[model samples]
Target: MRSAPDDDRPGRVIPFGKGRDRAYDAYGHAYDADEARGDHGAERRVDHLTRFMDFLRRRVAGDYEVDEFGFDPELTDKVTLELMRPLYRTWFRVETLGAGDVPAESGALIVANHSGTLPLDALMLQVAMHDEVGRPLRLLGADLVYQLPVLNHLARKTGHTLACREDADRLLRKGEAVGVFPEGFKGVGKPFSERYRLQRFGRGGFVASAIRAGVPIVPCAIVGAEEIYPKIGDLPVLARILGLPYLPITPLFPWFGPLGLIPLPSKWMIEFGEPIRTDDYDPGAADDPMLVFNLTDHVREIMQQMLNELRLRRGHAFPPLF
Candidate 1:
């Protein structure tokens, strides 16, 4: 019979629509999102504050832990990365490409050109990797980085270690993302005229480390760092006195005092290329100097090509602020 028309029938269909559900909207959400726009913002603020408070509590109670490399993941994630996000997002407006090429959970070595006056590029790269792919890029630093008191402390806490084969191998074997700037100070301290020109990758140490760890090597290209502080000149005497690689003399820096230290708001682009697999190599291939050297050169060439392409895409350094 058509007695109750199927309204009370078993498993009755509700026909999708806002007013169709007796409880809440089935198409949109359990609650009307449009009706509470301001509420979301307020909730976010509350959540942020709560997290900050929790961080402070951990610091006070000494409840934080560090890895074997003295990497304080808590501080790096809660404080360091959060602080760098604004610079990566607004100031430099860094745009990342091919980030998905990075291995999701496996070990990999990232080889990239280094630039920018003070290694800001490294920090930006680290932030980008962590934010985009949810992985930490452990940077290998030179000896000088660990000699200075303040910089040494910060470096260790932020997961940086001596740029040695031992450390790199250890990190890679642990399934962690390792990053190396093979050019050292050469690429970062080069003159403005030589911008985007890669320097000789020292001895291919990074390649050997990757091979030993049986990890893929991902070549990365970073553009726009060259113009940030524009290494117009260098003060060798001052650099020697300060124990710095080079005392960069940008147009504004050391002239305008602290104001000169401000980096120009240049557009930045980072590209991660496909990983070159090392696991396929035969036994003991890591000890072969020629293979390591060849791989190193290949990575460098790919990075340079990527830089050239990215430069064309970025056009000029600065864009309209608005």
Candidate 2:
């Protein structure tokens, strides 16, 4: 802020603010007595812009790296993260815990309960793992995820593959941190009243994949996603016509048109539980239905328990973002 031009105090800050005491922080930048005090935040913002420009230069020069699955770590870490970080940090005010429980050097199957009208929980989880655990979490998405027009390409680039047993097994065996939401559409499409409820584990396919790959299954519980976009009703006929899972009718959507697409800024919590070792059993143990069923139930129980605990701590659905 430019104050009185006559005030001739070089680098001397006059404290005046409603929220915080006024102060000027310069990144070792010089200041003149008559000139306006420079803000470090502004300088840092310019630095961010410069880095982004360099990233664009790299992309334009075809100098970025991409894996066989079309996964671009450079784009995800540098570009896609810019889109997700704000929501994870500001809008939703997401709190991630137990990230240390995730095995750092080994492949692990991260199984989490899915909610939120859209698959925003998944995106937030991706950001949380990247920021907190310093790992690129690969998500096992459903067929519908890849069927969407623009999302299809973006998902692949973000390291999200189809939620097929084969893909899950392959990614895990390759020592990648893979995430799976076993409830699929049932978890996301369920009514708001049924929020946080686990639908079903579906023949324990995810467990089988984990067993085959001999990876630890880490149960993750996420709270606050239930309130992001409360699903009051569904348009089944329209969904079928569009070849979509379900046409969600939230409190704001359809009635409000594009404005309805805005997700409610509910607080979010993510907790990664201790790993349930599938390596304890032989790789062929996946073939045994009973073993897979038991492990699936165990994981589901742990996730539910964690969710219940997190909700207790969260209190209200829409806490103040600040």
Candidate 3:
């Protein structure tokens, strides 16, 4: 069993089977500091390898269905995880906290303040959940995401679904991790003046979803995302013409042309606060404005605290240059 690190440290990649194009994560899991041999340990590796060969043989013999879960028993959960190593490394230099609080097999609603203005924070969070926390988190993406060509395909492959309550309920019922940004596009597109200040969590859909599903809510706070592409202004007419939600005018890119899209190397801090249990709440509590308001206020407070703490932790904010 290859152990992942408890803290967010740098990671490297190692190749898997020949011509596989897959990679193994040298970095350990979020809570696991015990470094074990990769491939989930030697015996497990052999088992998976054998199973994979058997799977291939069966495929060649036309005796299998690829869609079935665990169809390739040889490719254990460990192997599947290894394939994601490279993706995490390229996107984030994450600093994690409260990872040990995550339950091994319980459903969770990960509520985060959406920043990065581009939804990259969501993808980074998903990668962190899967590779660092050792589990896949189903993301609730916006409807606009599915409208794009490649983005839509990648989102599905990465286990994202349309932001719908039914989908959330179904996943939680199955003990799966689900992530949602209550701010939605409004939060992401907020001006630079509003950086780190969370928008209102509308009608408490997340609260309702959690209460209905009887799951705990995990408040996630992310710093350094706001600097990714600081929106100095919005060209609403151009945005409408382009069919975009907002026409962002960052310091670079549109202002300075295409070069603006490159995100500055701002160190990232992502902390998961202790879970707020809704399991004990009355199912009808969703309609109570007091309940929704309190919950939203509570989560917002935690996120703000994290932002303040991370600002101190980082010593100084990196000059916000998009």
Residue 157 lDDT, candidate 3, scale 0-100: 51
Question: Which candidate ranks first by lDDT, i.e. highest?
Answer: 1
Candidate 1 regions off by >4 Å?
1-51, 320-322
User: Which prediction has more favorable TM-score, 2 or 3?
Assistant: 2
Candidate 3 residue lDDT tens string, 1-322: 4332222222222112221123333222121223334555776455545645544554466553221111221232234444544434644466667776666578999988887667768866765675456566778888888899977756665566778878878778888788899989889999888988888776677878888888899988888788788888889999999999898888885866777877766667778888989989887887787887888788778877877777567644453432
- Backbone clash pairs for candidate 3 read 1-40, 1-41, 4-28, 4-29, 5-28, 5-29, 252-260, 253-257, 253-260
TM-score for candidate 3: 0.74
At residue 48, what lDDT does model 1 achieve? 45
- Could you tell me every candidate's TM-score relative to the true structure? 0.85, 0.84, 0.74
Query: Tens digits of per-residue lDDT for model 2 on 148-230?
Result: 89999899998889988878888998899999999988997789999888889877999999889888999999898999889
Candidate 2 stretches with Cα past 4 Å from truth are: 1-53, 320-322
In candidate 2, what residue range of length 10 has the lowest lDDT sum? Answer: 12-21
- True-vs-predicted CA distance for residue 14, candidate 1, Å: 42
